[model samples]
Target chain A: MLKHLTAAIALLATPLAAQDFSEGSQARSWNLYAEIPAKFEAKVVDLVCEFTGDCPADCGAGKRQMGLLRTADDVLILAMKNSQPAFTGAAVELQPYCNQVITVDGLMLDDPDLGARNVYLVQSIVPPGETDKIKANTWTKVWAKEHPEAKGKGPWFRRDPSIKEIIATEGYLGLGLEIDEAFIAENF
Target chain B: MRHFTLSLLAGLALSSPGLAAEGTRIQVSGEIIDTWCYYSGVMGGPDAVVGSAHHTCALWCSAGGIPVGLLAEDGTVYMVLKVGDDTQTAGGDTLLRMAAHTVEADGMLYERDGLRYIVVSDVVSDLDITNKNHEDYGNVPGFSIPDPNK
Candidate 1:
């Protein structure tokens, strides 16, 4: 599975860039992503509920995995991420649209090797009859509200006090202070 | 240009009538890894980001919505689509619970564009974070954990 992906796609305009194709062992054209561009209409559904009948009233309240049940092919495309510089899932954005049909404009990635046929990264979404496209940035808003203290000039992860606290308490190796100290002594 | 390929996940077929991703069933064992950091070379080299040292960050990354990849024993990252009763792949709660843990799973495999995808039917056994590489490489990137000093 690791062999199937490369960091080459990280050079895209958006932090969401996913793949790169190096042809003939020489430098070739750089693509938008290792994914396909996709746009379509679908009903938003919680994947767990859709697959296991464990339907929640709020689709896990943006905490569960949300998918778009495509109207075109009835395909359940996992709406993987939002259009954020840092990694953010699309759950928050799509949860509100649960069971409601909406138009999606985004990128699609699939891995047949692991059986994930088509995974989606939503760049934008459109509610029924709405001409304007909603950028898949809902997670950012939620993050800001949740971590107003984390607001800063860099990626949210770096400024996130919660993450910083975790790292500080656990140490970078995630080992308690003792093991980390031993590792420090052994290495430096 | 984006290439159109056939998608076949285990236990997960396109609900489309008479149409579905034709996947092959198989049993595989490996560690659930963060494909973004592993491939992106962000947190550290591939070796630094697996097993115990990377476990904490792995949970954070998975929760953050980076696609979860199963770093197989042979060093392959099988992109996990759906596993067992989990409704969604990647950032799903179940995937979060399984973060960095190694497991032997029965599932279907599909290949397209030189990539492998999986839809796990059953997780036979979970080894639970067995890589334990922090002894060799301490907290790779040294950033996954913040510096208490600073």
Candidate 2:
């Protein structure tokens, strides 16, 4: 109870200290898989520079993995993926915010056991007192623009030409035509 | 000197949901695999998805932001969050290079959601794609090899 109270106080105080990410909250009811709705302040940084001191401008031009240098405890939390259906990374959304401290709204996937301390899935960027929210949806928009001919109603991965070609060439089992044929003939 | 405090830089307990102030150091040997395809089973069953067969596809997945997994000898898949010097959960150059290769790793292992995740500090030794299953599966998903004519 004291822990929960402290966390509640931390939430209200906003001193930018160690956030008890695991303290009971609304994320407990989030429908998304293992997502804890997170709204925290941090400075976005390029992981490459953080790791190897190889600092490139523009956060490696959204090519390198970006992480949040949490204002509290100075913990670096990786924003692994965005709120896209496919495993589209959070780079595009976080690129512009690089080297800047800002308030972010997203889902924090925590797996203490796996040591996935704070792998955030950025949904929208909402800086403090800012009404304009930057939503993480650049990937699909770019995909739609690029694949004009194959544009349709479905997940992008399914209609992906390369994936379709691969599946067609190797069959669903990915074990060559002969094996797939034999397996299907016997099983189905 | 810990760039990312992912659980523990050396050995410190993290919080609940990731680690509860207790960390485990592990030395595991396994094949680096595309976790997305492995779990999704889109290409094939578990058997055909690893080794020399899935190398090309694995590379594509790694580049396309699908985090790679270390399929240990003990049949446990550990999500390779950050590797050696190249920090990043996924889509890093190191991950792309390590794709489909078998290696021995020493790192902090975290057990969560009945799965495993590791931020490897050192890739002890890389065996360099030694599975040799391509002969059996013959380029698991043939489209992975782009057509020269195109």
Interface RMSD of 2: 8.9
Candidate 2 lDDT by residue in tens digits, A38-66: 76678987665554444555666666667
Range of the 10 consecutive residues with the lowest summed lDDT in candidate 1 chain A = A21-30
Model 1 C-alpha lDDT per residue in residues B1-150, reported as the tens digit of each score: 123233434223334222245678889999998775565444666788887778667767776766688888887778776777664563556786677788998987866434566778899998766777987877665665555556
Query: What is model 1's native contact fraction?
Result: 0.21
DockQ of each: 0.18, 0.10
Q: Which ten contiguous residues of candidate 2 chain A have the minimum total lDDT?
A: A24-33
Q: Model 2, residue A112: what's the lDDT?
A: 41
Model 2 steric clash pairs = A111-B17, A111-B18, A112-B17, A112-B18, A112-B19, A113-B18, A113-B110, A113-B111, A114-B110, B13-B21
Give the runs in model 1 whose Cα sits over 4 Å from its true position: A1-33, A111-116, A148-154, A159-169, A178-188, B1-30, B35-49, B52-57, B65-98, B103-128, B132-150
Q: List the lowest-lDDT window of 10 residues for candidate 1 chain B.
A: B10-19
How does chain B of model 1 score on TM-score?
0.83
After TM-score superposition, the amount by which residue B132's alpha carbon in candidate 1 deviates from its true location, in angstroms, is 4.3
Cα displacement (Å) at residue A134, model 2:
2.3
RMSD for all candidates, in order, please: 12.1, 10.6
